[model samples]
Target chain A: MVLIGINEFIYVASILFLIGLLGVLLRRNTIVIFMSIELMLNAINLALVAFSRFNNSMDGSIFVFFIMTVAAAEVALGLAIIVMLYRQRQTILVNELKQLNG
Target chain B: MIDILFSIFASLVLLSALAVVLNRNAVNSAMFMIVSLVATAGLFILLEAYFLAILQILVYAGAVMVLFLFIIMLLDVDKGENFNFKTRKLSLCATILGVLLLLALILNSFSSNNLPSVELFLIEDSSFIDPGAFDNKAKAFGQLLFTKYMLPFQVIGFLLLVAMIGVIVISKKPKF
Candidate 1:
């Protein structure tokens, strides 16, 4: 039998990811949306680390390292874009910035 | 003992994540995000990834969250959008859908028959592992990173540089 303890980490990861997804879909605030994205990334990292631990390998952890680097870069660029967007539009609500719908 | 700790950290992570999503104040949400991230780092340590846990704290909780708070303060947002009756209904539907999805993942489909049965007791001790072991220790990570993953490591460095330049250009006030 597959022990419940073994798969519990995966379960938590899934829940965390779902919460992040809900955040992105429901929140109009751009900053909160960005935070949701970070939460999702952390969830994936948790699952990867769990898998690495179970498999007795280092590959997944290494992959997570790369993921963190990418996440850091993405956050810096995304926030910069948000700042620039705010400068041009003077608002950060997603719904209010539909000028490109044309 | 480890399982108990795991449950605590996981619950902490989920609750704070929910707070991050549901909170109206951007600053409060960012603070909750820090809590969620740090709790996730705790989970990493439970998984025996000490190096990753530290990186999670330093890079994610420390640097990334600070940047988020900085942007939030710089924007000086007056108030968050209110969830009217329509959004409340929409969120209700979304919550139902998400809960169903979680049930599908955790209940019927993810049984042991489909998964590779690795021994869970390997991490029971939760003590300091010897350096020679091929676990998630820092020494082993360095060896693997320097050997098979060297090219990708360099590529990630270049990607960071590119992202830095792009951010600088995008955020700068136009000279003209």
Candidate 2:
């Protein structure tokens, strides 16, 4: 008598992903956008775990472990880049960073 | 009982996530992000991924967020700017696109019936890889990592090493 359905989890994940997408699109700060990307990754992880549990497999959990590792590495690198940029430009606003557009 | 817990955690995740996005202050956003992450960890517990739940808290909520806070404080961008883009057109387009995607998801979800219904008790009682076999969940994961997942584990280690060197190089002041 499971009160919850797989589709419900899927829906929650999708909505969370959408919220992250909206955050990425709407936010002006670089750090906030970075957080939005993390949120997106979290949403995908939720979906993966849900499917893994429903399907009775440990593969999805393994993939999640890998994703978390990659995400940690990505955060370290991305923050370093942000720090470097701030050292030079003294600001982290996304709109002000248009030197590469030309 | 589980349904209530799931709903509570789900709503907590959603609200905190929204707060993370909507908060004007970076520090506030970071704090809210932590809340959102911990709530997601709660969802992981509901999913019976005790190992992942701990990792989610330790990695995402603990380590990664502390880094974010350190950077935020280091840079001192305490005052947040306007939430929306300066250009009205761009903001409108983004909002419209997000709305459309949400609509599509909802429509498809209602229209589809292919997802199989599963019994929670059966999943909990039997199908999950014999929890007692390895005597410990962490041990089970370790065995899998050392055996079936050996290559990827090594690759991840290498990737972490590369990332470490790359960070040092990127952050170091040039010595010209």
Please tell me which predicted candidate would have the highest lDDT against the true structure: 2
- TM-scores, chain B, all models: 0.83, 0.87
lDDT per residue for candidate 1 within A1-88, as digits (tens), equals 2243447788789889999999987888888889999989989999988887776667888999999999999999999999999888
- DockQ in order: 0.59, 0.62
RMSD of each: 3.7, 2.6
lDDT by residue for model 1 over B44-158, one digit each (tens)?
8887789999999999999999999998898887464665112677779888989898888867455646565566545332223542233655767787778789899999999
* Chain A TM-score by candidate, in order: 0.94, 0.97
TM-score of chain A of 1: 0.94
Model 1: residue A69 alpha-carbon error in angstroms = 0.3
Candidate 2 lDDT tens digits, A1-102: 568877878888888898898889888899989999999999999998888777766678888899999999999999999999999998888888899999
Q: Looking at candidate 2, what is the lDDT of residue B94?
A: 79
Alpha-carbon deviation at B163 in model 1, angstroms: 0.8
Give the per-residue lDDT digits (tens) of candidate 2, residues B1-176.
88898899999888988998888888999999999999999988888888999999999999999999999989986554645454678778878998899888878877755476676535434325553222115665786788788999999999999999999999999999
